[model samples]
Target: MATGNETQVREFIFLGFFSLPNNPVVLFLAFLAAYLAIVTGNLMILVLVLVDSCLHSPMYFFLSHLSCLDICISTVILPKILVNFLRRRNTISYKQCLAQTFFLIGFAGCEPALMAVMAYDRYAAICRPLHYSLLMSKRMCIYLASAAWVWGFLDSAIHAALASQLSFCGVNEIPHIFCDVPPLLKIACSDTSVNELANHITSLFVGLFPVLFILLSYVCILASVLRIRSGSSRRKAFSTCTSHVIVVILCLGNGFLNYNRPSAGYSLEIDTLVSAMFCIVAPVLNPLIYSLRNKEVKGAFRKVLNKWTG
Candidate 1:
């Protein structure tokens, strides 16, 4: 419990769906399906990346990490949402809330950086093919992937540390679904100037900087792709990038909307939907995007299936 001059809040009530319909069973079933799909889809990608010889490349190596992050980001938020759908009240203990916030923000922060790394992987493959092996060596991949995860959780640790210092003072109603720094800050009765400042400053590094990196990487990639004179070569090069590009757009777009929501004008339902898009829909779609777009992934899936059946 946070100690302050007033009574401390030990738990928080989620107002995520308070403004929506009164059907718990329907909501429960719906979210359960989403969670299952998220796990199954991302897990398939991860397993394929591990087992398929054809997928043992820098691109797929980074993709496997992206799949893991997608699963983690969804798992951090969705299970709690599913459980709350069954309960009479949508609530989380203060400690649980903080833990959720930490992991959710950690995984969420990790994804864009990871995507940027994946873009760099693509950039190296297409733009610097002569040095692709050296640029994305096994050790290099491990280091870049580790850096993304560390960057995310380190940033998350800072936010979680700041959040822990906040004195709720009996005000614990979080306006959104899961525990996040923004909603938590909204309910904090103490002076939140420091938290807000940290949030904005970190948003630059954690959000904007990586996004800029991705755009720059893609710009270089597009230029390189265009320089290839053969139409077939251009198509093949573009095909390799389509899946990553779509996944990046979906994940980053939903995330941007989720985090940058305006302070006052939106309704609770809108808030809930936006968070769901980020936490639920994006994860579920990523594997499908790759599977459908990438011939390699589909062939790997077929190969795995044949081994299992035949």
Candidate 2:
């Protein structure tokens, strides 16, 4: 039985990217290309990390997990959007909406935690070179990866539980392309003070906290790099950290803009574009960033390719 405050929302109508005057064929082709790139790029990273013995380190291990997260995140949002584009219908069932939101939050939250772990890996490599292997052993890497997934799982569970508690009397249209927390909450008939507050607090802890930790790790890393007597060594260290920093900025910037807010007067257009940056662009860029910037990953890719071709 539905509670007094809990009313079943049968389906949500997605007011997608078509609100703009762009050509549907062009939009569909562009997103299709992007989706293909993200999947292929992340999949290649995962395969390279798994098959190449040279890439079997804490950093690549974390990268593999991050690639997995990205693939899942893109899959959760992009497929439904593609279907909507093809069929010209934006309807999604209530259960499907909640499920997509759950996985989206889970994988999205997992990303920063994985980045933080990678930062720690770099710190161990640069700051404690002698103890690097001891600190970031296979068991430790497994534990860190597991912990990131577990954290994401718990966070998503809380968000979904909170969302399930809300009542949606009417206005089933979701303003954004995807089923996100803030956009969905905007259409709720019941007072969403608790849900909004919880979303804000969780966003702070999940979004800001990992970013601060990554920044702190980089600070220590920078100090260590400065102390290195060789100029070449300093440049190398800086180059390695740059890729991670770029990804951190992209993830946190879009994330803060999307989740860290009250739903009042939110612009749907701006939100969709920002969400695309993280959901679509970030995943595609991550492997490319690391491949182009990190010599080890580049070398590993070459060696793998050469062996396959030979």
Candidate 3:
């Protein structure tokens, strides 16, 4: 160990999936399969949203963005993970590590905010139907989506800057699969109090705030649904948003669990597993969750399928 914080940080060694058996080839193959699934699923969602005129609405628009974010988040994680596992190559340059941290957090931040936007769209669609068109016009949707992406980038950029500037004397092995903020902070020799504070502040706004907003939106939606006199209308309203609700729960729940923790409670094995869920499994399931559960999406997908196969 280089004492006294003398050495400048250069690179990091990721102790990837340390709990897994010592079988890099098998691990790599599994990760590759998962990565392909994530890509194919999200891409399918994107295509359906684009081609199906029936889906040319605010909900599908938001979903298209969500699918894009899923693809981005997974791409940032899985390829590198698959490659490293294959070659048993865990070393990442300082630049590469910081870039990974920046992109993944950026996309992760976007997800909750995007979900909140989708929630608002649902609220308008259910709670205020007369005003839905006026309230969620194309321009308004653009604004909300842009706001989500911008805030996410800004929040993550702040964290990335702080983490990259920290002094690292010697310890370079990252205890997790990726360069997430908590683990990166763990190995830093410099003081991280301010950095931790920044992380918590950003995490609060982008993560917790959006979750609360989504919950509040859904509560209002539930009340509106109850007020609807027709049973069929209520069922249709609920069906429209069920997939999004599930997606919100998975994305925000994992985010809250992963980031809103003290370093004192850090566990490498647990972190790796959680990262796997958030970075890989969630993205792969998003399209399936939305398509398989929603009647409209299934109908649209079938049309698209028949057009190709017929």
Candidate 4:
């Protein structure tokens, strides 16, 4: 039995901000500016981390990876958005849509685990400063970072595989800006019980476990910081963790709010705005957050600037 929805839905048409004002030029300019800023900001961080010996520590290494992840996540979708604005075409092929969805899921999943690793790094630095070098050795950092990225890709593969098996025999219109698990699942005409269940399960792998680990590490970190006798020493110790905490909150708060929720609250406009926050806005903010808040990064930026100018 061939359902009409299954046979006809070969492509997806995105109704992107179409109902807002119907102005593609304004949208194109805005998105172009954002895309340029995100690329330049993240690229500066990447280049500095690579070139500066002062930033060769485990923290900066992980921060570089975080920068790379932000670049990747934002890049995966922004080009298409830019194309849509310029060409006035918001259509994505079935295969391309799935590929986009896969990369997005993989990168999004990697953040929590990477953040957890960073939390542990901070914990090791403050809670066990004497053992920081031995505990967070070069090999160990590579292993942890590699595991996070691999797990993210594997998790994304599983979800994409399952979603591919689904029969999207209904309308090919995705309510939001891009192709995503929940949005894709929303349009499926076939049984999505299994797919949705898989979506739920894989998300825990992506978000919950790592978040718990990060929280646990922070608790230990906070306890250790409290024991510092001098006010300046305490502030110095606490300052290192503060930016990470801010980033963690921004990442996890926006992330879990949408991905971790049930489908009952799904609104098209709301989802678009929220997705833009984490996907588009967060990446742009990450580099600024790291550079402005951390003295090391700021100092390194000054060194680089002076060296180049000289």
Candidate 5:
């Protein structure tokens, strides 16, 4: 299968933050701290959800899943970034690149669907309280969470398989920070129409559809909240949904900005910043948003803390 004058690309050199004005050590420290915070914050959410008796309901069930996803998504990208910063070289072997691409997309893809499921949970709670038990039974919650995980991995498999087939023709420099499909395709010497087509199609179904579902669910949630007669009851209903709404907006907005760059494309620094925001900052913020906004989560944390101290 050897082609004339064609060499295989075994590794890719990342031109990400290396060329930036800041010191690499400084960047590494900042990212390291951020990664720790992401892990700590999300881990707290996970433990509270699992151990707190009051958080056993469907809403917190879905929050636990989201917390897991945030940790996973950050792990897939940030560790490599930290290593690269310390090594003073940004490089990933071909196999490692593909693997990273697989898990990164898999975890990132799952969040939207999970959030949509959470929206449905909220919708069921507020819009159909009498039937909420029937609508979000324990078994139903498990099935929904399972489906979201499966959906993300299946989508990622398609892209990773297609990406593996690409012939880089000894061109292995990726313009972006991570091993994303778009940057890989840009540097690929082979025909990328298929990969591009697949990306576009998945963008529509995997990316856009879940977001639309979340929006519709929120619209219905808004209507239901407004219909509540008691001012206190209305405020309580709105408060429960507020954290989820802020998180969905933050995650989806960053994702949109990252993926939907102008056709001409931004400068490399801008591109890198956008990628960092999507992959790094978003994960760090998700737990913080929930912890600060939700009194229930705070109470859960306090209860656990007091027990430990006692």
Candidate 6:
């Protein structure tokens, strides 16, 4: 019953980093260092948030969860990549590929929503200082975080189910380093028009909608900051928002570049780099940006460091 153009493919070969002629050892060491930095940095932040009493606020709570998510995100993708680099072959099974794709989509979709929640936290803090605690209550924070996780799981399940339905009866050489939706769909033997359309619409909801919410929340935050009468108060508010703003720009900018437009005729090389940034670099840098720049986080770090070392 097989057609001429269709052939069953069981595994995908990842064209991993350094497809060109280069020192594999050097690349492995470099990525290992980056991976270690990401792990230790995010782990430290997570512990600090958990142990430090002063960091038990809404902001730090969200940050701790974000750090946890970063760890999961990196763990899902980086170790395999590093292993592939170490080994001569870059092969992932069909099951592993599907699992990677599922988790990647889940976590990637959750990040912006989490960021938007953080933005709303900042808005409540700055714009309505008196009622900040009341607005971002413990219950509310838990609810928001639960909603994000649930939504991510739901979205990932939908996409993965759709992908599972498609028959991969063609070449299984994935152009990118990991299993991505567009690339996988390209090799499907059956009609993928429905899958592509669903991806587009879901990308709009998961990607752009959260970004718009974050932007709108920050616009209100900025407006409130400008209205403060005291110069010191204004400066303090601005400083508090700066770290989140930097993260927002990096995450949303790359997200827009990657997901906003249709995947038609996109360059594989550029997509690979962009995926690396959002998946690896952003998670690594997020904890660093907050811990290094925010005095409160630095204080918590010092306390946690002293307690552990002493």
TM-score list, all predictions: 0.98, 0.93, 0.95, 0.95, 0.97, 0.93
lDDT of 6 by residue, 1-310 (tens): 1256667567889764545456777767876887888899999988888888989999889988788888888888888878987786778888898899899888877878888899999999998889998999999999999888877778888888888877776677887778868778867778888888888788777877887898898889889888889999999989988998898887677667655545666666666677677666777888889988999999988887788899
Order of models, best lDDT first: 1, 5, 3, 4, 2, 6
RMSD of each: 0.9, 2.0, 1.9, 1.8, 1.3, 2.2
Give per-residue lDDT, candidate 4, residue 275: 69
Q: Which lDDT tens digits does candidate 2 get at residues 226-276?
A: 999999998987887788788778766766766664556656676667667
TM-score of 1: 0.98
lDDT (CA) per prediction: 0.92, 0.83, 0.87, 0.86, 0.89, 0.81
lDDT tens digits, residue span 194-243, model 5 = 99899999988779999999989989999989998999999999988989
Error of 2 at 211 (Å): 1.5
Which window of ten consecutive residues has the lowest lDDT sum in model 3?
A: 1-10
Candidate 3: tens digits of C-alpha lDDT, residues 1-310? 2346378667889885766778888888888899889889989989999999999999999999999998999889888888787667777888888899999889999998999999999999989999999999999999999999998999989998888778778778988888888888888888899998997688789887888999899999999899989999999999888888888888877777777655566577777787788787778888999988987899999999999999
Please say which candidate is ahead in lDDT: 4 or 5.
5
In candidate 4, what are the lDDT values of residues 44-127, reduced to their tens digit?
999899989999999999999999999898898889989987778788888889999999989988888899999999999999
The candidate that achieves the highest lDDT relative to the unseen native structure: 1
User: Which residue pairs does candidate 5 place in steric collision?
Assistant: none
Superpose all Cα atoms of candidate 6 onto the true structure and report the RMSD in Å to 1 decimal. Answer: 2.2
Lowest summed lDDT across 10 adjacent residues in model 1 is found at 1-10
**Model 3, 223: alpha-carbon shift in Å?**
1.3
lDDT of candidate 5 vs native?
0.89
Q: Give lDDT for model 6.
A: 0.81
Instruction: Give the better candidate number (3 or 5) by TM-score.
Output: 5
lDDT of 1 by residue, 151-239 (tens): 99999999999999988878878889899999998988888999999999999999999999999999999999999999999999998
TM-score of 6: 0.93
Model 5, poorest ten-residue lDDT window? 1-10
